[model samples]
Each structure stands twice: as C-alpha cells, then as structure tokens.
Target: MRIGYFLSCEEYAPDQLIEQARLAQDAGFHGLWISDHFHPWNDAQGQSPFVWSIIGALSQAVRIPVTTAVTCPILRIHPAVIAQAAATSAVLHDGRFVLGVGTGEALNEHITGARWPFAEERLDMLEEAVDVMRQLWEGDFVTHHGRHYTVEQARIYTRPPAAPKVYVSAFGPRSVQVAARIGDGYISTQPDADLVKQFRQFGGGDKPAQGAFKGCYAATEDEGVRVAHRLWGTSGVPGELAQVLPSPRHFEQAAQLVTPEMTRESLPCGPDPAPYAEQLKTYADAGFDEVYVANIGPRYAEFIDMFRREFL
Candidate 1:
C-alpha cells in the first residue's frame, strides 16, 4: 500500500514545516497530507500557518505530491479562489496536487459571521461549490448561477496541463453518497468496508481512498502513550466538538475532559509496530489504496521513519 505523511498544522516555526516535508521525502514517504485551518484547534496547540503558502514552499523543497487532507472551500474561501490555488499549486508541483474538500465546522466556518448551515444544507452548498470549481477549471469562460455561488465571464487562463483530482471527506452515509457522486476520490480516518462499497455503488469508479490516524511515535510504548495524550487527548472522542468554539484556545476548556490516561486508552501510541501497522491495515483491509499517518507529537520525522521502516 502507498503511504503518506500527515504534516501537523498546529503551531510550529515556518522553517520546521519545510524541514519536516523534506525529512518525509528523504524517509521515502510517497506524499504529504496537510491540514487547512485559520486557527489551531486549541490555544495550547499554538500555530496554524497559512497552508497554501506552505504548499508553495513544499512544491520547491520536496519531490512528493501534497494534498490538503481536506479544505472547506465553500465556507472559508470561495470556489473560484480554491480553484485558482489548486491549479497554481499543481503547475508549481509539476502536476502533483490533489484537492480534498469538506463542508466544514462552525469553528472555522463562522469566522466570516456567516451562520453555519445544517448538515443537509451544507451538503447542498458543497455540491454546488464543487460543480462551480470544476466548471471554472475547464479553461473556458464560465457563468454559473446556483443556490450558493454565481460566477460570470471568468476563465482560468493559467490552468494546469491536467485538472487536479478532487477528493471528498465523508464520515456519514449522505456525505459518502455525495463523495461518490461528485468526488474523484474519498477520504476518511477510519476504514469502513461498507463505505468503500457504497462509493463504488454510487459510481465513484475505482478511484483511490485515503485514511488518517493520529498518535505519538516513540522508542518505548509508554512514552508514546504519554505524548499522545499530551498532544491529542483533547481530540480523543468523536463528535465531542460538533458544537465548540471558533479558536484552538477554546479547545483547552473542552480538553480538560481528555486526560493522559484517557489518551492512552484511546490513541494508538506504542513502541510496538503491531498497533500502528494494524490501524493502518484496517483501512487497507477495507480497500483503501493509501493511508496517511498523522503524528500527534513533536517527533514528526521519527514517526515517518517508523512507518517507512516497518510498513512501506
């Protein structure tokens, strides 16, 4: 199976980000998965750099392809802008850019004072946004009037040699159906055989699926668990932040529920390659062609090496 490294978006020096990408490439990682966020999930999380700029830098520094694990174009930015960014990045990377998108959360989506839509409405907006982006990227004059966006007399003259592939992040049935219908590929954190089958059933074709999992990588199992809790205990449970604040600092309040002990129980942080490889295999077993591993601690390069040595 092909493997990718999920670069941490939480606070880091800019040079560190570039260095991490370079290190991942040197370690034989196939691609890079990045996060898109205006703010870190919590104050303790520290930095959330502009991902596009980082991508631009990675285009020059690394030989591997890069994709935003998922960006919310409809909410944080317009589809036109996203299309342009993707096109530009693809050209810069010599056609190694993929676009992954989702409907997004109020935490990041509400920064523009826009009311967060219900799940169904958000899906509608996403569908329209994707269509608009695709139309604009075809290198033709475009005019679109839909429920969410309207574009007129615009064409992307600097289009890439090939259109960048669009991937959708789906965790629910309706979202999965949307992904199958609209996206070139699908992304999720967990491996679900049913979701893969559903994607094919809905005309998703034989495109790739990508999954992400988080934990700390260390020389000893105990150290890994301790670091995992320190870095990601706040995110241990699913659906806990369906209604949280707008900034990473706010996560600290909720993160109180996530203790070191809880993190050890919840995340796959161990010296043993067994757990890490097993977690990745769940996605592989479910037929994911690629699985991206997101390391939760400071030892980003070390985690990449661990995965490369044991699995790749």
Candidate 2:
C-alpha cells in the first residue's frame, strides 16, 4: 500500500501545516491528507486555520497530492460553494487534489444553528449535496432545487481540466452502499475489511479506498501516551458521540471516561517501528490502496524522519 502523511488542522497552525507538507514531501511520503475542522475538538489542540487558505499555501509548499481528509458539503458550507473551492484547489494543485467528503458531525455543522438531522436524514442530504456539487463542477450554469439545497445559475469559472474526484467517508453499511453508489472513491479511519469489501461489492469496484490512523511520537512510550491522552483523548470517544457532540466542552465531558491506557491501546505510539509497522500491515491487509498516518502531538519532525529511515 502507498504510505502518506496526514496533516492535523485541529492541532497545527497554518504555517506549521505548510511546513509539515514540505517536510512530508522531503521524507518521500506519497501524498497528503488534511483535516477540515471549525474547532479543535478540544482547546488543547489550539488551532483551526481556514483549510482553503492553507491548501493554497500547500500548493506552493509541496508537490505531493493533497486531499481534504473529509470535508462536509451538507451543512456549514453550501455544496455550491464547496464545489467552486474544490475546483479552484484542483487547478492550484495542478489537478493533484481529491475532495474527500462526508455527512459531517454536529461539532462543526451545529455552529450554523441548523437542527442536526438523524443519520438517515443526513445520508439523504449527503446524496443530494453530492449531486449538486457535480452539477456545479460541469462549468455550465446550474440551477438545482433539491430537498436539502437550492442553487440557481451557479457556474464554476476556474476549474481544472477535470473535476476533482469525490471520495466518500462512511462507517456503516448503509453509508457504505451510498458511497459505493455515488462516490468516486472511499475514505475511512478504521482498518475494517468488512466495510472496504462492502464498498467494492456494493458498486465501488476497484476505485481507491484510503485509510488513516493517528499516532503519537515522543521521547518514550510513557510520555507519548500522556501526550496523546492529553491532546486527543477524544480519539477514545466511542460510537455516535463523535457525530453528535455539539461542542468542545461536550467532548471534554465525554473524555473523562477515557484514559491514557485507552489512547495507548487505540493508536501506535513512541519511537519504536514495531507498532507503526503493525499499523501499516493492518491497513494493507484490510485492502487499503493508501494509508496515511497522523501525528497527535508536536513531535512530527521526528515522526517523518523515522518514517523515512524505516517505513519509506
């Protein structure tokens, strides 16, 4: 499987993200995945720069392909607007851009004060949203009047020769089927073979299915665990809470139930290549075409260097 680096928008500032993109390219990583977030999950993460502006900077910073590790076209931003932004990004990156999208979480989408829809409702909205985006990308005047959105006379003026590929992120079987039916590719954070197989069986065929995981690198295993638990104990937040929690405080409250051991058990940590090796193998065995690993703390330079020496 191709190994890439993931840029955590929730953790690093804009300049830092650009620097990491450059460093990742220098490390011989194949591509890049960037998170899009309105808030940092928790305040300790301490940053959430405008992702579009960062993407523009990244085009100058690195030659590696860039993908939004899932943007939500459903709520906070209208699909028409997202389509234009994505088209411009594709042009900026010389068509080395993929627009990875999902139904999104209340944590980011709730800020517009629109009522959070149930899972079934969100899935319905996502399908319509993608349809709208595809219409806008065609470069013709678009007038869409769908159930969840409406766009009139919208045309993307600055588009690449090809529309950016849309990769759908899905965790459940129903969502997987929807992704397979409408998505150009697939995205996931888990190494679940069942979900990958379902996407292929349901209609996705041999399109790319990218997977990712978070990791922490520090001076020692214990320090890595503490840093991870301190910064991203939210990773241990179970089930739909990640989708339902409306704010950082709610995540902070849910995180009390999570512990350092939970973080350690959940992700690869510390300096050893053994755990990182296992992570790569698991994603490969899970049938991922590409896998991206994200650093949870501040030691990203070391993480990329370690990958260059061992993983690359």
Estimate TM-scores for all models. Answer: 0.94, 0.99
Reference-based lDDT, each prediction: 0.82, 0.93
RMSD of 2: 0.6
Q: Which stretches of candidate 1 lie over 4 Å from their true place?
A: none
Q: What would the per-residue lDDT of candidate 1 be over residues 183-269, giving only the tens digit for each residue?
A: 999998768889988887888889888888786778777898877766666575347374345665666767777777887765678
Model 1 TM = 0.94
lDDT of 2: 0.93
- RMSD to the hidden true structure, all candidates: 1.7, 0.6
